[model samples]
Target: MRRLLPRNSLRSRLLGDLWKPLFCLLLLGAVAVFFLARHIGSSVYDRWLYDSAMTLAEQVRVEDGKAVLDLPKQAVEMFEWDQVDRIFSDVRSRRYGLIFRNSDLPPPPEELQPGQSRIFPHWVKGHAARVVAVAVPNPADPADVLVIQVAETMLKRNTLATDILVLVVPVLVVLALLVGIVVWRAVATGVRAVDQVVERLDSYGPDRLLPVGEITNAPAEVRPLLNAINQLIRRLSDLQDTQRRFIANAAHQLRTPLATLQVQTERALREPDAARHGQALSRVLKAVTRSRHLAHQLLMLARSEQSGEKALQMQEVDLAVLARDELERWIDSALQQHVDIGYDGPESGVEVYGEPVLLRELIGNLVDNAIRYGSVRDDGRRGGAVTLRLQVQPIMLVVEDDGPGIPPSERTLVLERFYRRRGAGGQGCGLGLSIAREIAQRHGARLVITDPPQGMGARVEIRFAR
Candidate 1:
């Protein structure tokens, strides 16, 4: 069963994570504002109601110890036409008395006592009414009871609350949307700097190490990352400059000696003594051959160190045939040293793709190096047998010898340029294996050295990629 993974849309997820919290906070704030407005509005209305009630109660008088209200016309109008009703009652009798009230208004249920107030639910002519009852002492006559009541319809109060909500909700929504847009833009602006840096780095290669010129208006927090990127560009440019200088110097130094040896060899052939002339000719030829080999090795090393993808002119070549051809070419030298050289593999061709000339050089160098350093034995033999075998399925080439194998600790060291082993007999430069390794790397192959089977000799294996 496959489990579902979260979808990969960034904007959707960002909104999903942000909108809930933001909406909740906005809703809480709106509710708080609504309740606060309602409380303040109700308190102001109650104060107006109390003032009107007190002023009307002050105009009352007592006739023979009975209370009578002398409410002014302005005081009566102060209740407002929208108010539900008004009433006066006797506080001692606990009964309603002179009620100069509108027929559309509901009366209070009971009279109010001295210093007492009550709110009553009233229905007046198809409208809701809120009635307040307050008690007052008769000022002119003692032992007289009076009560005043005020009522107002709730239509205006409901309209005001609704108006406040209508005005407030839209403003809150607009503010929330504006805040969301600002946050998204700010985040995008900040992250775009990193995007530009990545694009510049992606376009870079060994040939181009220039820093990105565009600067971001990022916050101070991200300054370190931009600084580090600039530092890396500087370091890479320095390394590339150093590598170019080294290659140039090596080519110049090696070419001079080669040119001098070629000139000297041509001049030395003019000797007249027959025997001496032959010996000198042989020495000159050997020197010329050594110089040519050195030049070839140096060129191969320089090409391998170049930083880019090389164009490999690959073709299918037979490994067994190539190995046999190289061995036959070196047959005379093997016979002189009394070394038995042989190639062992399938008679049919084993095909591989690479530069055939480079492959031949790689195989030839391994075989030659084995014969030179692999000749000494405990039985006092001048040369030993060298065998080259190709394993077709694994795409491997193995060269083995009865000569003393390199020690385990020095196996890696021998592959370095000009690194010669102790007590080894060799006249040529120690670049044969190094050149072979370089060519193997270019062909996407690995060269490994280890003791051969039966612990008798060294085995060199070149394994090619499939």
Candidate 2:
């Protein structure tokens, strides 16, 4: 039902918004003009009525204490000169009333003072009229007398009003149209910058995700929105770069193991001696193990890349408990590799807010990496000690191995996915530190590699903000 409602377009709405108020002003002007025209036409023609009444009064005289008017034929004809109007005149004494008249014109609506002429409006003989009365003093007559009353038809006044209307109405209409046009244009001009911004944004694509050609013409109200969009584009570009790197790294890691497996399988198929066959089989198994570990790391990295808040369990779990459980899984392997791994912490739990499974992976990766790279050199000689310590003073987990420490330059690079040191061994696919760092980040901790206080080897410290 709501979809049926008409949507307002900005241009039309702008023009209409401006026009409504101006149209109301125009209507007010029209009403004022109508009244003005009526008043002006009545005022200009009222003088003619006064003149005719004065002419009749001049011929009036007092005879035997009664007023007599020696009104001539040509003199009376002067009042009747208008071709479109009928005129009537009456002269009466205030004391001795009803001296002379053309018709039974009534007395003025209100009394008149001496030398003052009053105009009244009425209907006469079923026609509209304008009435004027003048009070003039007659010294020769004994009566306190009034001079003349004249009533004229409305034809001349109405014609004058119509003429004024016809002349002025066209000009007013044209002016109103001009004003409306100016208002519409002004409204359009005010929002032109918004239109230009929209057009520039419409033409944009990912390849053009920069400044959008600098919308200098856009309105100040939209500048903040543009800035926010630019920031988002920059973030998206970084994400794209990271994704490309991840894909390339995954492909390169998998390709090496698969190629090794292929060659070993071919060698096993061609071998006939039982001892050589077992050697080929063992090598193939090792390649399969490496490939399987690489695939697991890739899957874990992908899962960790999801929205951390959603993927993480909010319940508090003990970080030190997870470390112990994961350390137990690696102890046998560490002992087999002649690496002495020990855990030092409180006998109980060290509580924290995080997903236990991911934290286990983080601890497992750290321990496994220590065993693989820490103690034994390639010639089977042991020289290093692996220690896992959980400190409570500001809540930190520390994993230290006594081996040749990572060089200062490569410490940072080694944490990136699939980035390995120059002589790094086959025990890792190089994703362990990267995965551990990602989990630490999800748990709002910083993973930093620093020199162990014991002089040699790398210390991977996961520090929690208290």
Backbone Cα, N, C clashes tallied per candidate: 0, 0
lDDT of every predicted structure (CA atoms): 0.70, 0.79
List the lowest-lDDT window of 10 residues for candidate 1.
Answer: 84-93
User: Candidate 1, residues 1-466: lDDT per residue as tens digits?
Assistant: 0111245444445655777899998889778777777666666666666666676676565666555565667755554544433332222223435634434334434555578877665665566656666776655444544566666666556666667877998999999999889877765666567767878888877589886664758657567778887877776676676577557756665676567666656656776778877776777776677777666666665555442234677788887788778778777877777889888888658877887878888898898888877876756567888898889989899989889888999989899876778777654467778878888888889999988887988899999995
- Give stretches of model 2 more than 4 Å off: 1-77, 80-210, 221-236, 268-289, 292-404, 432-446, 462-466
| Highest-scoring model, lDDT | 2
Model 2: per-residue Cα lDDT over 1-466, one tens digit each: 2311334766677666667887787777777777788788888778878887887788788678667876678877875667898998888877777778888788753467678888888888889999888888765564475669888998878777778777877888899899877876666565665666677768877555444445656567667766776677666666566567668878888999999999999999999999999999999999998899899998788767653424566678877777777788987888777788899997557888887778888898888778777775656576457889999888899999987778889988989888867665546788889999998899899999999997788899999874
Best by TM-score: 2
lDDT of model 1 at residue 64?
A: 66
> TM-score for all predictions?
0.44, 0.65
RMSD of each: 12.7, 6.5
